[model samples]
Target chain A: MYTKLALLIFIFMSKLSASVVTTLPEFAWIVHNLNPDTKVINLLQGNEDPHFVDASPSFVFKVAKAKLLIKNGMQLEMGWLPVVTQQSGNEAVQLGGKGHCDASQNVNKVGVIANYDRSMGDVHPVGNPHYTLSLVEMKSVIKTIAKCMERVGLEYSKDKYTELLAKFDAQIANVKKLLKPIKMKKFMVYHTEFNYFLRDFDLISVGSLEEVPGVLPSAVYLAKTAKKAMDEKVSLVLASNVSPERYLNKFKDISSINYVKAQMHPLSSDDYLKHYENFINELVDNVSL
Target chain B: MRLILLMFLLVTSAFAQNNNLQLINWFAGADIVASGDNLDQGADKENHLNDGMLVREFEFSAVSQIDQTWQGILTLAYHNELQAEEEHLEVHEAMLFSSKLLPMANVKIGKFFLGFGRLNRFHRHDWIFTEAPLVQKSFFGNEGVKDTGFEYTRLLGGALNWKLTVGLTSGGEFKHGEAHEEEGEEEHDHGGNPAPYEPTRYLRASNFIEFSTIEGIESGVSYVERRDGEGTRSSYAGLDLIYKKRVNQYIDRLVQFEVWQRTTKEMGEESFQDLGAYLYFEKGLNRHHGLGLRFDFYLPADLEEEEDHDEHGHSSIDGITPMSNYHAISLSYNYYNSEFMRTRFTLEHHNGVDVEEEEESFQRAHLQFVFNIGAHPAHVY
Candidate 1:
């Protein structure tokens, strides 16, 4: 009985000690795979919108106990993460802290705008913040995370990271082969979420359904987009689960261009690899060659 | 104008040199408003809501992570002459924040909004309604309570996600049941002004939880105490709650409620108390449109008595001036042009017993525009 009690206490104490906190499930998956023994908690759930998450108390609690915090930086989590970090009072995770990891530091960015302002409607001034959609960018983010984890004295396996990189390269090649038939296929997205994905697979993007991120398109804009779709022979309209259904339906009815729904982020890190593979397969199967 | 230009240039140069400093977040904003009232066409008193278009307020802020262990922020606010006798600019907040001073605690020093009730800590531009709630206006002034202070906050991580904050400040005089008061002047014994009792200390504890991905709830309790030069004392206690539901990316719902009570003790006079509360609800129809409603109720210190006598033993109470209850209701429509631009139209009705002990009512309609530029920090939930 005493031994059992000791073991339970040890388990509880381990949970109370510092752990890793991530802003998204994708980062959680990478962290978990990189160090299976490390504890990982994700602040954003699968269904929540990343652009406008509430600074919920649970997020502060998790961040407070975190020794390391990893975020897909380019201002993707700007709306809510700053509040959480400040409220947590955890110096390790605050901006410029030793334990803070910005995964976008070394990754190549796309959709960079010049002289950007809010008039453009929620434009990310630096670049598009959706680099996680690309496997190559994810690899770069993993390297950054590994280095940050080392700096914070968190246990990480370089051998495992090397193995993960090799696996990612194979998956990248597989994705390239899967989309070769539809390479350069013209398509439009609901948001700029898929820019990295499109660039990686050599796909052509005609335009976006949303003239500005987070702002609903007007009827006139939709009409113009429909005309552009026909003129450009756009084969598909790629939308996420959070995209407004009414506008997508209206655009489809007007242009007769089929659209496909993609679950942009995985719900669980346990099966993240499978989800990534299936995400690519779904896109290749949906687009007409 | 030259000073403003020079300040802007200096900030621009600093931003150009530092990659981590965020100059735009909460840096600049404009509040434009037009209101029509039934009280008097254009004879409204100074500082009272007028019947025409006006630039309400402008704000500029600069914030930076100074180092690995500290952050600094400075905000300057300029209000239209309607808010005062003369147009002027004020240093609204200049603070340094740090989390490394102590384990599991954050520290803030300098001028800032006290850690009080939920809405009191947020700036007016961040408020859901065009004006302060009736109760908050009477008890904490139009801008709510703020001063130079030192505050400590701790997040107690557990199932409930609790947070506790305590503050001490070189406080200012309480609003003492008045919506508008002039600087360096105190109105005493009109409707129970704790004119000399300055709020000097405060404590607030808050918590929040997510029921699901689509819904969440937050609640907080706050207390403040003030003391006068002559040893008069006043204490305020408040409770606030909020519930939010996200139906989709474009649609959401919010319900907020706050209640406060103030108890006062004079050197030789009988102790008295006042109570007030407000409830607010809002619904987002889509990304661009929303609707909101707010109801407010207030009762001054003489709720249990018929009148109040001055130190010279003369009765001065008259209807709602010091002895009656007041209620107001407001309905508003909001249009969000973008993340940084919003327009709101509000219709408000107020009812109360007048100085003549007769029921008096007034109505007003307000159109307000708020715009922001540069990077602003994310607001707390």
Candidate 2:
């Protein structure tokens, strides 16, 4: 009798549920808000470094069960995504398959190092993979996700995704209004992760803490950077919490530059826009035009 | 020398300025080895070319996504050791892959490394250690197996994340001195006759699964059957396992193990059974630094004697002496200067297989530096 009930419940659940896997939580956030009913599985946590995600078996099983898999391409997911996909052996989510989605396909990429090499410290040959940092770039990625969902035969309706996108545009415009006063502002970041965010905000970055992409700055390089930041009146020191900041710390107390750790992605925000709002609020609190 | 350098620069400039494609990579590397052998480690007696500090390896590589469905990789290499008379262009690997074969499968063709063991497919410049492991040197002939071949990969259905692969090649030619030490210089190692070409068959199944809740494991099994039609018939089987734990955001602790066994049948002779195994441990202290240890045990297959005795041969515990087994232990520390440059220091202790008396193990040390420049494709984890 219990077995019959279990089978009945299984059938019911299977009909009502569909699973979606995303390499990054930013993509997960978009998919979750689009279809509240679907099971959205995020492979990488919000604060985790996207480049070095270990292809754990649990995550592989998640990909195995997923009908669709979305990833931030441009070699951002190159380290492990191919390995996971191949191991999952899920034909549906394999490259060139209908259910596979590369969010970078339609977006305009910045920081594209043309003649690439390891000299650039783990740079993406195609371009930087941090597109979701900017709300403007996120729109393009979101649109691509929607088209992919339709192409892959996800249950989520096109009209509903379109509506969510419209709401996101409005949310972005509101943030822009708040950030308008700081428009064309100058700031300095420890890493180049904030390039797209600054590009969208019309802000300027004079120098970075690390002279090369991932190498730690030498004392001489730091001194020179501090001078450059001061001459340009760079007001904010932007960096992720995990990025070491001893070099940036030197200039903080001596100069007017204020250090603020930016959120990698949504930590506990209930919605996508709120995540951006939290980061924007932190940015505005530290810097003035 | 000046003319050659100028010609290389001219070719590189042409590659960089092309409009249709501009992604070109150049890897220039050299091995500076300081070795004044305190105890003979079986290298000098054979008169191998691997002694002393040497500048070698100038290679050019490129990977192009031809269109939506096709991708190609081409690498041409020049080795100073092999270019004794004249500089010869060696095509290391030229591969073309098709993702449109089937929704559930992919196909690749051309000359490439056979995807068997975890470390076999890695380039020399990308190795975790300065030298090849004992089993790889003995079974794969110093340079890990590569051949002009076609392969098909299919994703299997399971929660374990399994994949099935099958391939065929002209032959899994163990090209000696083409890359590293085990050039199989002694013709008598293969009974004084080595067939130029043969048919080879390969099959492998692998999976990456969770070892525990947090730690992960990758494991695989492979079988290869080889034949030259004249005298020898062989079948090789291998088992590989890897366990890794993420220590923090920047570091990983890893352990890898592999075992290989084979059966060989020679003309008018009985088949012999042989086996080998290795264990490797690596700790990533951070992104820029790492420590590693590797231990190897090999019981090589006995071969028909064409000459009285050659360099390397099979040893059996049940035979004259169980001490004939090869044993090696290596410890290394690595400094990843950046993505483009790296330096490694290694100290190894090994019982020389060619040494008749196995009382004392030889000590060997190496310091190697390697660097790459321009559009190198990202290595797969």
Candidate 3:
């Protein structure tokens, strides 16, 4: 009886130690790879748009118990994550707390506006937050996440993070080489979510179907975008799984440009590297020089 | 080379400090309404929903993480009082909050919306409908329960997502009794007592559970009590439920239901109880459009009937229609232009049951325009 009680206590104590929570599944996948021993919880489990998370009670429950919290930052999770973390009453993961990690701290950013207002639509003040679409930018976030793990006293292999960063660098190089033939292909996107990915591969984005970030474009704006695509000889119209399909079909019907919808963000799966490789293969398979 | 390196370090540190100082944010919002009612005769104070347009409410707010351990929120509002034919500026909320003061607890101090019923805590602009439901308007007045208070919320992390909140408030601004007027109180009289406020205490326990991958439900129980210096006491108990079904990213469904019971007793009078309830349902057609419906019901305590009868043989209660039971149904269509703006059109029908005969029924139509600018954090789910 004494031994059994001791074992139960040990199990409870182990459960209370250094659990991590991330706002996005991609971050969780990276954390699990870097620290296999740490128990990680992901707030977004499906293809729900990161911009409009529900901040449900289950998310608060997970955040309340986590010792460390990670977010993509740069206002990507601005609408929901702050309220969940605040309601969690977990000081360790609150804004200025030692266990809080913003993965966009040192990333290379694009689409930063010096002076902005609501008239410009839902634009981030700290630049575009879709840097996760680029593996090169994600290397910087991996370093930030690793530092946060160390601060939380979680056991993580430094060599693993370094190896992961090197692997990302190699993949980025190889993809760029494979897509060299279509480096300057002009394309239009449903949303600006793929700006970082296009920038990484040296592709030219003529315009977007959505003039404003989250709002559907007016017919006048759509006509102008289509005319611009036709004039620029745009190769393809790019979209994501989260983009509105009906509007994409409307734009395709008007512009006569076929769209290739990709999954820029990873789902709740451990094989995130496969997602990246599959995305690269889809681009090569769809676009022509 | 070493001096240049030192200067670069100094510049970087200064830049970081400047960024920290910019964390304080200020935002503003406005709600304008164009309303029309068919009621021929009513006092302005009794029914403030007029047949004209008005800038119903305008608010400015500031929020800041004061430091690593404290956060502050301040909101000021200017609203047109159609009853008084003037615009009044009011402080909606000014509070300092901290989560680091205690383990698994969040503390808030200063004036704020009381931690009570589900709809009571949300600001009018955040509500789905343009006007308060009949039950909410009768029990908590148009704005719902807001007071100067200290609130402590405890996050009891468990499988059921349990949370508890307790608040003690100075109820100087507590307002009620518009629809269910007290005895001897004249019509067109506004409510809410001034200074020397009575002390109000409230407690609420909330729990949430996910039934499936796409369905989530949250339920809460709340209780509040207040004692006036004049020996009048009031107590309220409430239950609220919110359910959400996420069919897709653009299409979802929401159902909200609430029931409240209030008991009031004077120094020498027998206690009287009032019951109120509301059920709301909304279906999202897509990202931009939604349809919503709400049903409201309120039953007031017993009233004494006057001995005299009118020429039409209709009984009278204090020379007025005895609206013992009241219910209303509202249907609304909402258009979300973007994250910053929304337009809503609402149609409502109000019916009352009299002790002897059927009280008059009325219809109302309202169009509301709500817009926000600057930096405003989204409200919690």
For B1-381, candidate 1 gives per-residue lDDT tens digits of 335546865866777678645433446888898987765532222223546888878888888766667778888876763333344455667899887767678899998877789777888788888887777766675665667779999877555667899998865533422223345544232124443445489999988877875578889999999776556677889999999887554438999999999887767867787788999999999878999999988876663443332331111111124236888899999998777789999999877764345565768788999988777678788
True contacts kept of each: 0.56, 0.19, 0.48
Q: Counting only residues 3 or more apart in sequence or on different chains, how many pairs clash (N, Cα, C under 3 Å) in candidate 2?
A: 2
TM-score of each: 0.89, 0.78, 0.87
In candidate 2, what are the lDDT values of residues B1-381, reduced to their tens digit?
A: 334455656776787678644443344444444433335344333322344655445566667666666567766665554213233345567898665446556677997777777666667776667676767656664445777889887767454667788989766354333323233332221212355336678888988676543377879899988765355777789998878776434447888888989787766867777788889899998777899999988875443342222322333211112235778899989887765677888888766444344354566777777877654554544
Candidate 1 lDDT over A82-200, as tens digits, reads 88888877887888788889989998998788787666876787899988778888899889988888998888888899998888899899888888888877999998889998888
Interface RMSD of 1: 2.9
Docking class of 2: acceptable
Clashing pairs in 2: A116-B375, B176-B183
True contacts kept of 2: 0.19
Best by TM-score: 1
| Candidate 3 chain B lowest-lDDT run of ten | B309-318
- Alpha-carbon lDDT of model 2: 0.68
